[model samples]
Target: MPGYGYVSEEQRGVVLLSDDAVIPQVINDRLVTAFASVTITNANVTGQEILPIHTADSQGPRGDESGWIQVVSARATCSEGIQIKIVLPVHFSIKLAPGQTYPVPLNLSIEGDNAPKSMRIHLDLADLGNTKRWTVSTGEYELERREWGSAYKITFLDYDHSVHYAMAFPPEGNCEQWPEKRCPVVLALHGAGVEASSSYWTESYRRQKNAWVLFPTGRTPWGYDWHGPSFWNIESALDALRLRPGVPDDLVNSVGVNRERLIYAGHSNGGQGAWWLLSHYPDRALAGLPAAGYVKIQFYIPYFMRIGDAYADPLLRGILESAISEHDIDLYASNMAGIPILARTGGSDDNVPPVHSRRLIRMVNEWSRKTTAANLSEIPNQGHWFAGVVDDDVMQSFVDTSLQNASTQGLSLPALPSAFSLSTLNPASSGSKGGIRILQLQVPFRLGTIRVHRQNDQWILNTTNVRRFGFVADDRQEGLQRWSVDGTNFDKPPVVSGKSYLKGEDGIWKVADDMLWISEERHFSTYGPAIHIFDQPFIIVIPSTITERTITYRKMAQHLATSWYLFGRGGTQIVRDVDVLDGIAAQYNMLVLGGPEDNMFTKKRQPGLESMVKFLPGGGFQIDKRVYVDQGTGILFLAPSPTRTRMGLFIAGTDADGLLRAAWTVPFRTGLQVPDYIVLGEEYGDPSTGWTAGDGAPFGGAGTKGAGGVLAAGYWSNHWDFDARCGYLK
Candidate 1:
């Protein structure tokens, strides 16, 4: 009724029951049909009313557009285990572009007889776009679109609580129906702007006889370029198959994905993501195939265009760039020494030239003790895309061999080499090798390395810039293991619970009595650069009382929610202080908006933060002895969660105007770092604002286009304390 009209004969703007419906002019004679369907399975004890919701995109209508899309809604009924389709709610309008996605309510009342418990039903309709963006297909195999709710809120373009992933069943058969044995899975990542539904993404791959390929939407077509939230999406999708978190147990009962035989493969941006994930999560995959992958951001496109770096302080730049150092895939290449890799590229291509794969191959060879672990395949006289990029004889052979090897190894880690090296910049993102993990680094954002070798019946270990490390002994290995770490000798018995941890103190390594899991010091999950707060499920906590100040705070929260949807395909949950209980506060890392006076949550926690940051009674705040009473000054910082092991990101200002200025510093993209904390002033302009390409630069350069700049910024100490050396004051 909202977007359509009927021929008017008896009245000017009234339609009779016998009149035919007319389509809108904009859509204009397109072959339209209901192309998308969302199946809703009732798993409850009794039939209840269900209101299905749809997610709206952030790219709202433009110009004179009404900013709403018309969609037809229907009800799904089940009669004695048989599904019956019924059309209802002829047409309705839902808002699309609101910076962030909100649930568009659909009317459908289910009765017990029609929708009994354990019944499966679906609502189908034609979307604004006719194509199903999340569907994947391979002519030879059966591919289906599956959705599962994320453990954390994504706050992406759609209010739909579910994240969609494309699954291509093995050539043998659909694993869901006949999963007598586990099938190896290839986690394929799509390039930037490449739709998950595209046949080119999967059809070009040489399919294994019994392997399945998984394609994640990465939240959106270009979501995070398979980093940050995009990376987490892959994890969630895999978990859904294995019946882990964020999925229903009945979704996939049989063991489908072979946990030990997983492979990572991609092309273009996905190729780069494959390399990143392989290095960061080496233990997850048996092999990697990255075609047309480029090197890190700085190497991909040199920062010769960055205007600010010429005169900026070296310390500031280092702190800022530290946030993105993980993007440099080469830095963590050593972690993949034991894993096999097949790197490919087009020799004649200009986009992501051949040198990238060549360099990556060379680096892996240089770091690997087994020189044959990595190989390069260069296609001559070809550009970026070619038929045999990943479907050729060599590629097929590699896949077959990798799967064969995985079958022999089962799900256990391949026999570890007596001597090997583990390199990392961020311990949180990087994976462990051979039961050895780097828990904490002496200096954050700096290269940390550990080299281990066995000599003369004793295990010798050397570490660089490592503060704490641990080793979990394997049950297969017997007897007491003698260790010499940095010349400090110790004997550890490889018992049932053989976990040994050590910490470096004043150049000497000592057995640390404190458990690594409960350590208060900045560890893997708690590290930060402001942007890391979104890596987990976080809540936006705003002031409960309605006021001019609270309204401004709410606006800031809305901006953040929208930004996440646009850049990271993330979902955010915004709540008032009064609605957040103690259990909720302890469970989630909060993004607390407004100062103590306006936000009750902040007021209750201010005393604990007084030593480092204290909000004044009337207006303004103080950081260590420096006082800022200006209405144009804003403060942003990450503090340890007062109630739990999580982190809390505080965004507050002297007043509403300052809060707006501070919101600019919260990064939604790859580049533009705002370390642990920063003080912003509306003077020189907002630091690094504008389009942030996946490359480390903003719009091809260090952007400074918004209305303010960083007044003071720095990292928190290893223990989350204010350290003078890590801070910068104006």
Candidate 2:
């Protein structure tokens, strides 16, 4: 729109190639005009409006093909280092009023076969819809076949009860049967909201691997219509699985059960339920692998609003438990007994953080004092999903060890960098400060949160309190030590940030440069459990690049500080972006989107709406609710808004406190995962709200905090819009 005046902003359509260098596919969308700009106080040129364009989501699954999303937008630059690229499907329009919405469409792609958490599209935006932040996988890919069933029902033959949508999977290659007996029955239980019968678990594909997997959906509530029981229907499901025509009566007693022996595993939602199966009925499962929910999910249930209310049903829980305790977490402790186990999780995972698995390992080691029969390992470079499932060698080890280890391997944590390790534990003094058991992280990493309590006589930081640990360092750092509380340099060591290369890349590369807060120019010993702390800054080192053809790059390092958030530039009136705020408030919790609607906070129109709301606070994502301040029962917190929009009548609500351990997204490894410079922010924290009675909404003034700043305004798909930026903060 180079002042090529004449064309009034109107509904239109055009198709062109994408901006990212990786995937260049053509996209179609309408053209629109945007008036956006940054104003400075005491300047003669303060009152000016630049371009403001917006977009909308396409129909069903349009603009998706061959690992790339069809996104084409009109881009402009109002300031240097700050450019906007917008790609609108149908939701994007050229006709927008003072308070109309331009829907944001984000389609992320995943590379070839990786784990659940491995390389997927991610919208890295604060006000999620303001930008187009998603994965753009452009890696070496191989055709992968993932056929699984859904909506399976398990019947408890003895009791004549039935669990619908039970799940199972056979080997992908073959389902060759054994000479005698039946396939080992993997009594796989689905997590809350997940009907055990769906192909999400692919029990059929798993069955092809070796064992006969069986999924038993939980029972529906006695009186409630859509409601379901809160625990796993193990007994009933097992009875039903055994009753199958081709299956055997007793699975374990028979060797070479089915095709392969019965091995047990489940991801996030399912992972939580797996604990209950192992706990209440350990004998049924020979081996159990609970990903991220073996401990924390159970511990934080009561505090979680979604599950907290459900605890009222005595039959649904143990007296008073989070109604949704991942269904199986309750019986997890019992499963630790004699059960050969392998637990895996991500260190950077905020939802059902790694602390859950870490705690399980801690409890077992303290009691049995050995990891012989069981072991818990973590993938610090990952988050909630099972990223690089088969690649990281974590799952591969799990498949190998869970089948072999008859005893524990003495659960041992890998040595992390000092940046993540807690150096001291000076507890609140009612008594006095104790000796410091320095949580010495090896090097080149950071820990999530560290809690120092008395581990026997010495002060120690264990996984129970430490929540999670993110591995930032490679295989070169030192370990932890027992330091005195009064020692100097109380902070953990630093981490450098610069471009660095790992297994692949054009010669030397780095994670981040300038973002560093600490330097790795110095050397430190490496060991297990790299310390990760908040507010404590550190650097992320990168692979240094030299000559063009040089593949061997030296390590480059810089530093970055842990971040906190704040916003208060305007009122809450900006909730009208039906495409953005509405969905975000309903799905995320850290921040509340205040507007003139109730449906955003309810589940009438959307089926999984409640599910999103249910899990966000504690389920995993930590998303909260959207409501007016007039509604009571919610707590409140505030943040600073870059956009100085008049604070509309938006009230923050207190969904669940401390329910969100944390939320974050690792920068994409290759430019393939997501477009670079996308506006990314992990909305974490309990949804808290308050009444907004300010005068006119905080106007996006001639201040540094502009109205556009209030909204998550950024270069969407490498483009931007500058409409009357309003109501973004609360």
Candidate 3:
């Protein structure tokens, strides 16, 4: 009988069974167990996979030293005339010093439920010349020591995905006593391609002595440098840590954080994320350190050759540029004025040019008009990875300074800073900073800033793109006796009610409700007027009943669900319309697929959807006074949820074909051109161009009445109401 052995090409380790080995076969329902012992020595590792062995690409084994190796055992049962395959996982941790070679030894043994099997193999390190220094294995491995930290996984109610994070606690003496003690937190984001699930990455931060180091997976190996959904993943990770039994109750509380001493730091791609989070969420961190980071994706990788840029259409360019502007850190650089930042890059690094960091520092200084620019350090003659960036004296000093400030200030919220500014894209729940609250956002996804400066005895409020905002006054402080709105002086005091206030109509005070204020808990929808849906979890509802033709809708729903999963890294759930429970609408944003007749949820909610678009009986859709009955026509729009104020996206058509065509357009094209609502027309040949094309090909054109092309297209107002003036209907 032939014996089987386990071998790893990447780890350069193998477990071989001798030719004379005898293995046991299970008899009728009997239990069995197997065991193996293996030892390995220096091996000749000459492959690419052996060099960068771990996911983090930082630590591995060396040929000169004895590599750490361990074996896992397993067993399987087999019935008469049946064969089974059993697999076991092996772990290896190796780190070799530079330019060393040594002969390796191997010992092997096997026992239990099988005949004795033994094999020996030696690895030669001579083949790898002085040029190669180290060789390690690919895949996860258990750490030899437990001093680094512990790994954990958590799931949040608002997110469809589970998050993975690593936490490293401070040394015993470093930890403060309970009740009166609060340790500073360092949120260290990993670079692109580094898996936080592995102990290798978390172990690197163990050198930081006095702080609780948090390493979040950023939702995936690659997550847009922690933008959009990735940012939320970090927040959810923090929430999970607070509830963990291992964490002290006072260290991480109900709000999920020790907000005062929070510090953000990152390297490479994570470096970019540190900057992004710092600018967009200034209140979340005390100071930020970004190393070898880029300013924006466009700057890092120019988009001049993209399809949108190739067209060179002013309209198309405007739409594309406006959409991504919210993520451009330079545009929001001024918001970093009040916070401390230390940015660094290696002068010899070619991966990410050092100029990006220099330019950002200059922009922040110019925009804020502050004498002190962001501190920039360029290490000379160093490459992308430099020593002391994470645990250097300079970094330690910065953290110490920030922690001292927090300790002096205690836990109370700081008073509103003089000459401070607040900016946000989604005012509904952006968050409060320095006692100011943004109540409404006139232009969502566009920057809205409120600047306040106390001059002499009056408080002056300077606003841009702001619809409504308020301040929670500290009645104990008596500085400003009057107020000025946009250069207009008002003798009346601002309205105040229950810790919040709204700017009064006549410059007087009016009671304000917390519901109207923007909060960190704000939810977003996918359809128009609420384009930033990444912050909230969403579900897709397919028709419960299916026909031969309606089966295509299932495929369409899959495409959408997959796109969202890839984009957000697992925040999408799919369910049949019948299985969608009553309160689900309130819990998640709904994407209802299929026509009214085919989908139970759509059919039941049709009456409530009439205000937006009505699916008339017999085969057409009615919008206002016009009726669309084209065979290939499809309707995609957003409406208020029947059960709640949240939004629902509806993709319905006259039939299956229309629905498929519309669904395909969304995953491929739909952008600013498709706007809040769109009606796709039949596939036809364009006589003028002699081309067979769909009316919505490329991107759906503006809709018009009596036209076989795009039937209609328009945007909804901020209030989620129809905008007749902005829509097209021939």
Question: Which has the greatest TM-score?
Answer: 1
lDDT of 1 by residue, 302-345 (tens): 76466555545667666667777866888887777777899989
Ranking of candidates on TM-score, top first:
1, 3, 2
Q: Worst ten-residue run, lDDT, model 3? A: 48-57
lDDT of 3: 0.53
Q: TM-scores of the models, in the given order?
A: 0.74, 0.30, 0.65
User: How many residue pairs clash (N, CA or C atoms closer than 3 angstroms) in each of the candidate models, in the order given?
Assistant: 10, 183, 19
**Candidates 1 and 3, the one with greater lDDT:** 1
lDDT of 2 by residue, 479-566 (tens): 3223122121223332323322121123221223241211221111111011101111111111111232111101000001111100
RMSD of candidate 3 to true structure, Å: 15.9
What lDDT score is found at residue 430 in candidate 2?
Answer: 7
Clashes of 2: 183
Q: After superposition, how far is residue 691 of candidate 2 from its true place, in Å?
A: 21
CA lDDT of each prediction against the hidden true structure:
0.60, 0.28, 0.53
After TM-score superposition, the amount by which residue 437's alpha carbon in candidate 1 deviates from its true location, in angstroms, is 1.4
Q: RMSD in angstroms, all models?
A: 11.2, 25.9, 15.9
